[model samples]
Target: MKRIALLMVLALSLYSCDTDDDGPNLNFTIAEITGTDLPEYFEIGESYDLEVTYELPNACHQFSNFSVNPYVDEETDSTFVIEIAALISYDANITDCTEEGELTDSRTIRDLRVSSEDYNNYQFKLLTGEDENGEAEFLIIDVPVGEPEPETPEENTNA
Candidate 1:
């Protein structure tokens, strides 16, 4: 009797599920990167803050997250290509997203650790909007990797 009751409840629950349609529909949109703040060079084994600036497509759009991917060039032994993009999400229900000619500035910082594996230089490709031909554009930045410098002790003023 208990087994039959459990099976009946499960069947009812499956039939009454509105899981497919929640309420507001959300979609992921890629934001164009405008600028970046970083050091001229990165010290291996040290972490540095990389600031990025991007523009939202519309007022309804929001900052979702960051997507970064790395690709190694076959022609170069130590060159690495890093692509960075800002992911924005907006609800499809909001139809008043017509804030044209103006953009909302958004900034995000990421802690990038310099690794020895990325030997020579890091070619950062910041994602920008596509052109008239639908070709994607990127703001390329190259940062060289430096060897670890010797630590120096500070002199005590109390002496």
Candidate 2:
């Protein structure tokens, strides 16, 4: 009887020790912002492709990617406000990220301002809904400014 009790205690101790497969928990890590290669500024009418990428948990192997096109019209006032729209998708197997209960279909943030002086900076923000694990999260990304454009050039007959 004592041997059986010892074996039971040993089994319980071993089970308690096995805690590696906790399955990605609420903790998350965000990676630095990443995206397409492009210039910082675009001509008034010209459209540019903008993509912003980041990691989940803010410090883990899993990542959350965001893609969008944010543009300002030179013809219009440079101090206009614009919205950053992105299509967010997720991997079902993602284990170590904090998200809302379910993957958000589409997220539209309101009142993102783009002041004229801010042209030198690119801002990226994330909005997360509930995943299987209940938690809210976000990531902020700043895109480095590229080289400045030359003064407006006029058409010349020398060409």
| Leading candidate by TM-score | 1
Clashes of each: 0, 15
Point out where model 1 deviates above 4 Å.
1-22, 98-102, 147-159
Q: Model 2 TM-score?
A: 0.26
List the candidates' TM-scores in order.
Answer: 0.72, 0.26
Q: What lDDT does candidate 1 reach at residue 61?
A: 81
Residue 134, model 2: lDDT of 57
lDDT of each: 0.82, 0.43
lDDT tens digits by residue: candidate 2, 1-159: 999999999999999997687453433333333333334543433345444433233222433334444555355433332323233234435656554442212222333333345455554444333356755334545543444667787889796
